[model samples]
Target: MRLRVHRRGLFGWEPGEDALAGAAVTTTECRNIDLDRMLDPARGNLVIGARLPHMSLVFDRDARGPGHHLIELDDLTTKSFARLDWPTDSTEPFTISQLGPRRL
Candidate 1:
């Protein structure tokens, strides 16, 4: 699963609230957006931060068990318009933020 932002003006995205189509974000600025603080995975549940309303957290069924589990982000709505395979399992306390119009 992967985290994807919905296309602006589509369903969940309103016209003025849509992501800047071709805006570019610097890598330095990207580092400031904290995924852990946003998701708060340590709280024993999924948390959606105010800044990233379009993103969602996903986990495999096994992850729901009683343990520090690895999971995946649902990428069905990614800017790429496709999902990415989890090359390796991802543990909690990770961050995902949109750095630019097409970069996440």
Candidate 2:
């Protein structure tokens, strides 16, 4: 997938064109990612049983983190998915980490 930036940069990765000055920059990105290899069965509740459906696993990029977490089955796509919650006493970052995006 290609990353199209409108402004300078979202996470300071690349320089964006000045839209006000009528300048636009385009960049291309090609990734050969494997969803199966990046999946987390234990935490993601991907166990096959009577309750668990025999379907494909889906993953989404952690918008607020540096990794990706399991979302839901693609066949039954939904925005709402089960998330792992942290303890109230913990001072960790407000983001979940499953598998980091690999550049392979």
Candidate 3:
């Protein structure tokens, strides 16, 4: 993924346009990201024994601190998934890890 912040928004830092603005900035890119293992429905408990159905692995980005990503696996069935208790809802199938400052 690449990042280039130009201005700060109400919510958080906003991304710049296609081309860089004034000062040339370093485009940070995360290379060779393998999501195969992390995209498994079974990993999120959305799969049953020998009964894998149509599912959707969805993800939403949040530039907020403490949580940068919100990934969820939906079985697409009528059954509803449990709701998260934002403040303290970090558990299995719904966990968060704090990856500190980026290291070269």
For all predictions, the C-alpha RMSD in Å is 10.8, 16.5, 17.6
For model 3, what is the alpha-carbon lDDT of residue 74?
Answer: 33
Which residue pairs clash within candidate 2?
8-16
TM-score of 1: 0.25
Tens digits of lDDT, candidate 3, 7-78: 112223222333113322232221212232443545522332123443333444442345445443333343
Tens-digit lDDT string for candidate 1 (61-102): 334354333332222244422111221234323332232233
For model 2, residues 3-95, the per-residue Cα lDDT tens digits are 121111232321122321232212222121323333435433334212443223334456335453423221122211222222223344422
- Number of backbone-clashing residue pairs for each candidate, in the order shown: 8, 1, 0
lDDT, residue 41, model 3: 48
Where does model 2 exceed 4 Å of error?
Answer: 1-51, 54-57, 68-104
C-alpha lDDT of residue 15 in model 2 = 14
| Candidate rank order under lDDT | 1, 3, 2
